[model samples]
Target chain A: MEPIVAYSLVLSAVLFTMGVLAVLARRNPIIMFMGIELMLNAANLAFIAFSRHLDKLDGQVIALIFMAVAAAEVAIGLAIIVSIYRYRRDVDVDAVNVLRG
Target chain B: MNVIELIVFIAAAALALVGAAGMVMSRNPVHSALFLIANFFALAVIFLLLSAPVLAALQVLVYAGAIMVLFLFIIFFFVQPGQKHLYVYSLPWQTFFSGILVIVLICILVLGLYMGGVFTAEEHVQSAAMKVEELTSPQALGSALFSRYLLPFELTSLLLLAAMLGAVVLARKEGRGDMEEKD
Candidate 1:
C-alpha cells in the first residue's frame, strides 16, 4: 500500500531470487545452506513490512520464531555436514551423494 | 516517506543487494560468509526502518553475530584445499538454465504482486491510532509471545534443545566415541 512497503517487498523478492541462484549454481553445501538462510531472511523482511502495515505484533512474533527455527536448523545441518566431511575429506554436495537410490 | 527515510532505505537496499551478489559470486566459502554477514546487517537496518527495532536488534545479534560465527568456524576448521574455489569458473548448462529460471521466477512473483493490487491497496484501518513506540516495543512483543503464542514459543525451546543434542551426537567421532583419541 505504502511506498515503503512496496519497496521493501520488491527488495525481498530480489534477495530471494539471489538465494535461489546461489542454491542452484553453487557446489558447496554450506553455501547452499547460506542461500537457504538468505531466503528465510527475505521472508522475514516481508513479514516485518506487513506487520508495520497492519499495525500488528503477530508478524514480529512470527519472525522471532522463524529465527529460532533457523538457528536450530543451521546447527543440525552443519553438524551433518561436518560428520559427512569426516568420512570423506571433500564437502562438495555432488560428491557426498552416497544415497542415490 | 521523508527525504531522509527514502535515502536510508535506498542505501540499505543497495548494500543488501551488493552483499547478496558478493555472497553468491565469491570463490571462497569464508568470503561468502562474510558477505552474508553484511547482508544480515543491511537487513537489520531495513527491519529498524520498518519499525521493528527489537526484531532488528535480534537480527543483528542472532543472525549476523551468532549464526554467521558458527558458519565461519566450520569453514575454518574443516576447509580443504579443493574447496578454495567454490564457484565454477565456467557456467555449466544447469547453472545457465537456472539463471534463466530465476529471472522467470522473479518476474512471476513481482507480476503476481502487481496483479493482486498490493501497490494500490489502501492502508489497513487501525482500531486505535498506534504510536510508533507501541507498534514493536520489546514489552509488546514479550506480551504477545507469552500470551497468545505461548505454545509455539515453548515448542521453539524444545526444538533448540533437540538441535543442541543432535549436533553434539552427530559431530562426535564414531570410533573414538565420547573420549578423545590419543595421538
Candidate 2:
C-alpha cells in the first residue's frame, strides 16, 4: 500500500473526528459551521486520494460538486445565523432554544 | 515512496492535523476560522500531491478564499468584540462523548483501510505515479464535469441560485411600519 494513501486517509479520518468534536463541543453557530467545513474538506481529501489511487476522474468531479454544495451551505447557514443574531443579539446555540421542548 | 515524497506527506499531514486541532480547541471564533484556513491550504497541498491540480486550485479558490471570507464576515457581523467570550464547551458530557466518538471512528477507519489492503505500498506508488502521468488537468475535469455529469452540474447552478435567493430573503430587514402594524 502506498504510504501516501494510508497517511492521507488517516489524516482525513482524524480531521473528520475533529470536525465532529467541534460541532458537538462548540456552542457557537459560526464555529459549528466551520466544523462542517472541516468535515467537508476531509471528505474532499479522501475523494482526491482515491481518485489518484484508481486513476479515475469521477472522484474529482464528485469533489467539485461537494465544493459547490458546501459553498451554498455556507451561504444559507450564515444568513440564518445573521437572522438569529438579529432576533436575540447572540449566536449561541444554547440560547436559541426555541425549538427545545 | 521516495524520501522526498515521504517527507512532504508527513509535513502536510502534520500541518493539517495541527490546524484541525487548533480550529477545534480555539475559544475565539475568529481564531478558529484562521486555523480552518490554514487547514484548507494544507489540504490543497495534499490535493496537488495527489495529482488533482484542478481540485487543489478549487480548494484554494473556493474553500480557502471565498468560503472562509464569508465565514469571517459572518463572525464579525454577529459576534462583537466584547461578546467574544461565549461558552465553547458548555456541557461536560458533550466532550466525553466526542472523545469516545473520535476514538471509535479512527479505529474503524484504520482497521477498515488495513483490511482492505489499501496500504499495499508498492502497488499504490506505481498506480499513483501512473495517475500523476494522467494528471487530472482542468480541461479534462471540465470535460468530464460537463459531458458525463451535465445534469448535476446544471443542478448545482440551480442550487446556488436558490441559496442566493434564500440568503437574500433571510437577511432582508422589513420596514418598521410593517412590524408596528403586525403588533
Candidate 3:
C-alpha cells in the first residue's frame, strides 16, 4: 500500500479505538453519542482510504451514504436524549435504565 | 513519497488524534463537542489529501458546521453546567473493560488490514494516483451518485424525512392524554 493509505488506516484504527473507549466509559449520553459519531467518522476515513487505494468510486459513494445515515442518527438521537431529560431531568446512560420512564 | 504530502498528512493526523483524545477526556460535554469539531476539521483535511475534495467540503459544512452546531445547542439548552463534574471517572470497571476492548479492537483492525494484503498491494497505486483528480471531480462523482447510486440517494432522502418527523414528535411536549392512553 502507499504510505498515505497505510498511515490513514492506522489513524482510523486509533481514532476508532478512542471512540469505543468514550462510548464505554462516559456516563453522559451526549458524550456517548459523540463517541458514536467518532466511530462513524473513522469508518468514513477507512472507506475513503480504500476508495483512493483501489481507484474505485464505489467506496466514496458508500461514504456519502454513511454521512447521510449519520446525520439522521444524530437528529433522532438528540431528540431521544431531550425526551429522556424531560422525564428524569438527567441524561446519564446509567441512570435511565428502565424502559417505562 | 513526496515530502510536502508527508508533512501535511502527519500534521493533520496529529491534530486529529489530539482532538479525539480531548473529546474523549474532557469533562464538560460542551468542551467535548468543541474538540469533536476540531477532529472533524482535521478529518476534512485528511479527506482532501485522499483526493475526495467533495467529501472534505461536506465534512466541513455538514459535520463541523451543521451537526456540531446542533450538538452545542443541545449542550447549552439541555445539559446542566453543574452536572459536568459529577460523573468524573465514575465507572471504574466500565473503563477497565473498555480499555481492554479498545486494545483488542485496534490490534484486530490493524493486523487484519495488514495481513489481508492491504498494506502490500502496490500495483495500482501509480494508476490510482494518476486518476486522483478525475476521481473526485464534480462531473465524475455527480454522474455516479445520480446514475448508479440513484436508489440509495433517494432512500437517504426518505430516511432524513423520517428522522425529521421523529425528532419533532419525540421532542414535543407531552399532553395530558399522551401518557394516560398508554397506561
In model 2, how large is the Cα lDDT of residue B82? 59
Q: Write the per-residue lDDT of candidate 3 for residues A1-101, one digit (tens) a residue.
A: 88899989999999999999899888788999999999999999999999987778888999999999999999999999999888877667866668984
Candidate 1 docking DockQ:
0.66
Interface CA root-mean-square deviation for model 3 = 2.0
lDDT by residue (tens digit), candidate 1, B10-122: 99999999999999999889999999999999999999989999999999999999999999999998996455534234445878898899999999989987987778957
Interface RMSD of each: 2.5, 2.0, 2.0
Q: Write the per-residue lDDT of candidate 2 for residues B50-121, one digit (tens) a residue.
A: 888888888999999999999998887778775753434466587788778878878998888789887775
lDDT of 2 by residue, A7-99 (tens): 888788889888988888777778888999999999988988888766789889999999999999999999888888777676678767685
> How would the docking of model 2 be graded?
medium
> Clashing pairs in model 1?
none
Q: Which stretches of candidate 1 lie over 4 Å from their true place?
A: B81-92, B121-131, B176-183
| lDDT tens digits by residue: candidate 1, A1-101 | 87888899999999999999999988788899999999999999999988987778888999999999999999999999899878777666766547631
The candidate, 2 or 3, that scores higher on lDDT is 3
Q: Write the per-residue lDDT of candidate 3 for residues B1-183, one digit (tens) a residue.
A: 589989999999999999999999999899999999999999999999999999999999999999999999988998778665332336658878888888899899999988877678465545554688787787888899999999999999999999999999989878877665763
Off-target runs (Cα >4 Å) in candidate 2 are A99-101, B84-89, B122-130, B176-183
Binned by DockQ into CAPRI classes (incorrect, acceptable, medium, high), candidate 3 is medium
> What's the best-to-worst order under lDDT?
3, 1, 2
